[model samples]
Target: MKKILLAVAALALTAGMGMAETVRIGTEGAYPPYNFVNDKGQLDGFEIELGNELCKRAALECTWVKNDWDSIIPNLVSSNYDAIMAGMNISDERKKAIAFSEEYTPPPLSAYAALTPDADIKGAVAAQTSTIQAGYVAETGASLVEFPTGEETIAAVRNGEAEAVFADRDFLAPYVQESNGQLVWVKGQEKVVVGEGIAIGLRKSDTELKAKFDKAIESMKADGSLNKLITKWYGPEALVF
Candidate 1:
């Protein structure tokens, strides 16, 4: 009877281990080179790839959840998801809402792009709602037009609704290059430095999950795999850890 009881206990422990919960990572599937829906209608991009790698290294069973950029943090706090791997910058204001893992990418340059080189960025600037760039525009007393997505901000500039659109330089580079002179960087306007480097966001209470990711990130950085992935997505000129 004693031997049978021990066998039952061992089977219960094995079943419990097999039932480990899946960690759901939330992201905005609109931002390119960071997180985006590809032609196959599946999530693909730098963050998607990196997030998967991090999960693999940490031995976490993870899944991706598409969430709008504006409510990404709020949803995370509401327990809609386990973490956020959307290219979110680390800032004090955001830290008040959620904790961040160590930075995975360096602080990126923010710039203004408009139809003309001399566009008056100081007059009317469009930015994605709830982003650091929008906050900067508001503080600078510019006519800060907010959009729900990065694509809309550029559309505002193209349609003369805004004098310029401010966003991450990497996100803007492809548009400027493909515009065929239709869009250009605002002349005499230096790229702005906003927020700290990009990092994964988690609920303040998810210390164990945060620690797992932090360790994985540190491992990638130590072995230089992190830099290689950054270059693969952002190009050789892209900033690294």
Candidate 2:
């Protein structure tokens, strides 16, 4: 009887461990104003703050794990992380690999041109420089100067290696402010920019968790918590749905 009881206790312990509500979050600490590592090497940004709030509402403990942008999704699939909150846009291609929670944030795609004397991106952001390389092939015949990361792209524009970059408006706004208007934004025309909306990436099978997150997001939205965070981050004009 003693041995059987011990065995039962062990099984219960294992089940409890498996049921713990600990969520591991994956993020690229390189995307500024969204997710970035500070001067002290600590992760702090809009996404980070939002993640903490969502987890709180859902009664889940979160552990942040940093990885490269390229590996963020793959790592989530391999179970290296439970969710991704790296300011990722919900795209059809990514949806094929994993499931996404309802969009918690929305930002626009914007273009940035350098302000340094003699700096020009007319050649860099053209079709020839883009991966598609077909949009402006006949009209402009320009080439884009591609960088490995958003930071690098911005740096290139700042250092005169490139003339401009097209990136998330959230990140671009801060850059313009930091550069003291050295970088200019070409406002995106409605319905023409790439997709926009920030969501949490989860495993394809985690429907339960997704539902929970969606509920929390909806509750936050109804309570105006989400708007409050938006106001805190980008002020009144950024009240996204």
Candidate 3:
């Protein structure tokens, strides 16, 4: 981790930003609550605000970069950005490629929603590419159709491209609630445990950057701001730990 921080620091010096403490934070702006582009054409979401607060607490100047979900990690490794604050789950598979800060939220729930309560999910289910939800459907022997974004997954359901959509419960909840009878969670369906928890993604060598964010997260957790943020964005039913 220390080596990674030095690598980035060296890069910063070479780029003529010598001694600058700026960090570029990457996120998939398509994911709501975690991140999204607001109507004012500005980046806005729980993670965006949270990341800003973390940078403030850590005394690091930060900027936001929007990346596609499927390639978010690759971009990070390529130095397109320094860290990923997207709603990314911490998993052994990903850990091989990058290191993670301690989780900021408890594990998130993934669920299925269909146009009708009885829609046959065994047929075609939509999930974002490279997501655990997609892996779950494929492993269960269901037809797993991948989309690049959560909105596309839901669109696949409404357009008959898929029988159902699988995604984070918090992400799909608003769509289901606003769709009236047009969409509903499968009756009696159990939420799937997609991964361990959501955390910031950093290069394996960026130990200092990771430590900075980890310390900020710990402070937030200790002061109750982390739980407050979770409840504010994910509702009272949101999990905390």
Candidate 3's displacement at residue 186, Å, is 0.8
| lDDT comparing candidate 1 with the true structure | 0.93
lDDT (10s digit) by residue, model 1, range 137-228: 99998999999999999999999899999999889989999999999998866477888999999999999999999999999999999999
lDDT of 2 by residue, 1-241 (tens): 9999999999999988766499999988987777899999899888899999998888788889998876778899999989999777777767889999988876444444455434444566522122112232223444656554677777776676655565666666777777776776643321124554778999999999899899989998899888788768776777476
TM-score of 1: 0.96
Please list the residue runs of candidate 1 whose C-alpha ends up more than 4 Å from where it truly belongs after superposition. 15-21
Clashing pairs in 1: none
Q: Which residue pairs in candidate 3 have backbone atoms (N, alpha carbon, C) closer than 3 angstroms, thus clashing?
A: 1-207, 4-205
Error of 1 at 211 (Å): 0.9
Task: Provide the TM-score for each candidate, comma-separated.
Answer: 0.96, 0.79, 0.90
lDDT of 3 by residue, 1-241 (tens): 9999999988977877434479999999999988999999999989998999999888889999988999999999999999999899888889999999999989999889998888887889999999878887898888999999999999999999999998888899899999978989987653767899999999999999889999999999999999999899988889987
Ranking by TM-score: 1, 3, 2
Where model 2 places Cα greater than 4 Å from the true spot, the runs are 1-20, 107-109, 116-122, 126-142, 187-192
Alpha carbon deviation, residue 18, candidate 3 (Å): 13
Which candidate leads the pack in lDDT?
A: 1
Overall lDDT per candidate, in order of appearance = 0.93, 0.71, 0.91
